[model samples]
Target: MSDLYGRHKAVLPDWLALYYADPIEITHGEGRHVWDADGKRYLDFFGGILTTMTAHALPEITKAVSEQAGRIIHSSTLYLNRPMVEMAERIAELSGIPDARVFFTTSGTEANDTALLLATSYRRSNQILAMRNSYHGRSFSTVGITGNKGWSPTSLSPLQTLYVHGGVRTRGPYAELSDDEFIAACVDDLEDLLGHVRPPAALIAEPIQGVGGFTSPPDGLYAAFRRVLQERGILWIADEVQTGWGRTGEHFWGWQAHAENGPPDILTFAKGIGNGMSIGGVVARAEIMNCLDSNSISTFGGTQITMAAGLANLTYLLEHDLQGNARRVGGLLIERLRAVAAQLPGVREVRGRGLMIGIELVKPGTDTADPETAAAVLEAAREEGLLLGKGGGHNTSALRIAPPLSLTVAEAEEGAAILERALRSRVQ
Candidate 1:
């Protein structure tokens, strides 16, 4: 290990994972690429887990953050901050919840934590329904709701959590069922679970299971669950930390795919909105947001600097029609990857919507998850100057590919070619 790597290990928790066997210290980034401390350029396919939305070091975000820093970087939530108000207004409008109120936090974990607090308080219940193979956050409360064993470090939690099925369409027991049948089975399971337990405050789900390797159930599955939740006065919380802001391409919000019944009762978002600025928040109707009896404030949340970055980032994303770009470019990228997967014996599935995609790896001629091959592919890709991400609830055997929405056709093609070579090497 390099001296820096040794130092990192010494200071950082071992549980805080780093990518690649030999981790590269990223020195700078721009557009869809980053350079390591040793000045090796790499095509960044994962965008720091979808946190860098538009592009790396985009001038708009840099200028916004810099200008705001010159004036005032932080002012507690006690004061009226213009950038905060503006960003919240835009987010509230885009949120689709009636009378929506937005509360900013520093990260998605805190955002979901806030959402859970609101749901439980609003409904006067601490029970929650979470999808199996789902990952909400790292906090004590969120870990309880997380269904992925690898991510959920503890069973003890303040809320009562029941794991539901239907996150992964291919690997679950209901895999053989058709879409309609699958939805029906999951809905039935949800109903059965609900009948036995005290009414849950909300059903929290990722529109696309991010850390669960970008898995998703059939469209309208959540819509079906929404109907049942509505009957029981239980809220629906859409964890859009990785799928929000048109990253999924076809929809502005991941919840929109399951919007037949209506938008989610509560929506939590982080990661991409600030384009690498630390920003996260929860949006809900006024009544639910106002349910808290005591005054609560996020001291470092919605500070002037981050709010400015968020505003600039969001504006650039919309004005450039990056969502449509994600659709057009991401579609071509996935098709290219599907073709590449077809040639590799280890590739089990290449599935995703738009830029948010996952390529599952498995032992050839067998159904067993192949996390070793997955790691090999990651290292191989890095050697070829490409960066990718790995995730899976079962065994961390899926390679995640979520580049910046601003990724160009040429960049996408370049990254795909490198990844194809890596996967081929593993199979050989």
Candidate 2:
């Protein structure tokens, strides 16, 4: 038990396969760096899949959790709690949704499930529409809406969810369709799908597709889709699980990046909202949320400890202006990565804004990049004391870089250096 890896190997459940162990067991983390069991440190560029926005063990969040634990940790959602009310008020004020109401959960998947249920209840429709390459969650309903076929296998009855290609695939970041073309295709697809099935209860989408290879659709895509949904009287649900909480640079919420389009009727978030704490919430307009009165309620949705952590995390994000920092540092990293990509052979494109960036790697003979090369780069980076994540579909290959908002310029430069070395060694 003295050896970290041995201790874990002995006690870890056999049913769970390690996602990415790297032969290094993480013992502690601070800011943007984590120490392995062997006392080796690595710069964390993935940031817990964009979960630790404020950084590891943030002082303010720790204090709030500590204080709340000393008092009360759990309370049935049957009664309103002060921390829950305060967190809801903060969310409503910041979002500028005057009639905003919040429903709390412990994970992004649960929050999305709640949103889907709410959408179905309000619109009273069975069919749901989602974009291609989207990853909502692992739950049956959310997984059904997820566009990735690999994650969800073909079944006899797959929850009756409808799928459509968001836009035409282009030779750029996210498949691009001309604004007009995308709009026309979306409307036609929705019409065709609705003709076969009932009208959709809701149209769910991510402002920027995180698991969908960090794809960002062209400007006016959202606006055009909103118009179509409005014409059909369908609700719009924005899933900001990975892109919200100011991680996308300038905006506090990912949907804000498309404010010119129109705000979503229901917005869901998790990840950075608690700055690493386990908390997710759904923010809905009063009209949509009020429909919940006819449905069954849960007791542990909004516990006191989770609410406290969320409140403190939100306060810290606002007071310190971490959103601005994300924009600034993200710009710096994108520029650096772009420069490196220009010098590399297999590099295809560098996409994303703020801290949510992706490097698409293209192979020579293949139409798309080689996924193995992307894996090599990630492994090389880990060997060099840096960590990164990967994404994209079967023929696609990309390296996802989403570090903590607290990442410094020097650390960013160092990460770029390591990445350059890795790509250089692999390409030749």
Candidate 3:
């Protein structure tokens, strides 16, 4: 039989590329580092697109997955699974959504799709109000709501579903608008859309826009939007795929970062929930979830193994109190990044909360355009053995620094040091 590396090189398809994969094959990972096939170790600040909450190869999750694999791995949703039930209850309890009903899926996109379906079903409306530059998922219906034109280029066509945009300014959509003006403008836009479009089923937002350069909406944004939606009898769906599972710090839900607003009607979580175990779920009030009468179901939504992994990941998170660590470490990292921004010439802004941070880079003269400087910094960091992700539509110029919750102060400092060096070297 061919060796692992040889088999991968020989058999892997080319069209499967989503993000650019490193030419070097990664063999293993632990904590905040991953090793390539040739045994070169690299610091992982991107956290596998914010999925590795507990870092790679966490022992508890591995053991749970192994134990379940040894016992029963593929129980259909038609049959009751102990781990599945336990995980659902635990997630609902931790989320603080009373009597929350959950439907599990293997990916964030699937969870968002389920949430959209549920919202449409509950409100009996086809229209959806989504924030500009927001990213929900890649599935057909989910992509319909995603505001990033780069991700959903075809969405603008007449064949696509109708979606109204709220606040989309990048460098500052409403920078000129006063706090109250901004709020009024957003509400006015939504009201006009609702008037013309009639009734939108839901208003989907990413409390802090992840792919849109980690742009945090103005304070009280969600509360204000929720009020409007409530008046219109629309459900509120917070797409916490990138911001949930304690990555945002201080709170388990990203919407909490907005303000002390009431809970959303539906919350979709995926990235950090399983700590890289490929599990996603939608938690909604039992009444909202009960809208579907056996007509909506996914064949592999809640598999036995995925639930076991999720349960184990949650157990590890709770036992170790990693949420507190994310808060402390993430604060340190953000402060340090802000300090770096003060010295860096090309940095436009440093924004975001907890581990999900973004550093926007622009040309020295241009106020809004993203230049090659950001890409250069990323490449330099990679050469220094630090991995990062890119965001900001059409620009790909924001440095995405979403490390795992298991990231330590030392790891964060080390990564920040590399970033600082890279930025200084390029911009200076």
Judging by lDDT against the true structure, name the best candidate. Answer: 1
Angstrom error of the Cα, residue 174, model 2: value is 10
Q: Write the per-residue lDDT of candidate 2 for residues 236-347, one digit (tens) a residue.
A: 8889899888888878777775576568899898988877778887889998888977645556666888888888878888888888988998899899889888887688
**Candidate numbers, best lDDT first, in rank order:** 1, 3, 2
Residue 373 shift from truth in candidate 1, angstroms: 0.4
Worst 10 residues of 2 by lDDT: 166-175
Q: List candidate 2 segments past 4 Å from native.
A: 1-21, 153-158, 167-197, 293-295
The TM-scores of all predictions, comma-separated, are 0.99, 0.91, 0.92
Ten-residue stretch with the least lDDT total in model 3: 157-166
lDDT per residue, candidate 3, 72-170, as tens digits? 888678777788889888888877676799888889899988888888878877777787777887777877777778677455421124444444434
Total clashing pairs for each candidate? 0, 0, 1
- TM-score of decoy 3: 0.92
Report the C-alpha displacement of residue 354, candidate 1, in angstroms: 0.7
Q: Per-residue lDDT for 1-428 in model 1, tens only?
A: 39999999989999999998888899999999999998899999999999999999999899989999999999899999999999999999999999999999999999999999999999999999999999999999999999999998788999999999989999888999999999999999999998899899999999999999999999999999999999999999999999999999999999999999999989999999988889999999999999999988999999999999999999999999999999999999999999988888788899999899999999998878999999999999999999999999869999999999999999999999999999998863
Candidate 1 has a TM-score of 0.99
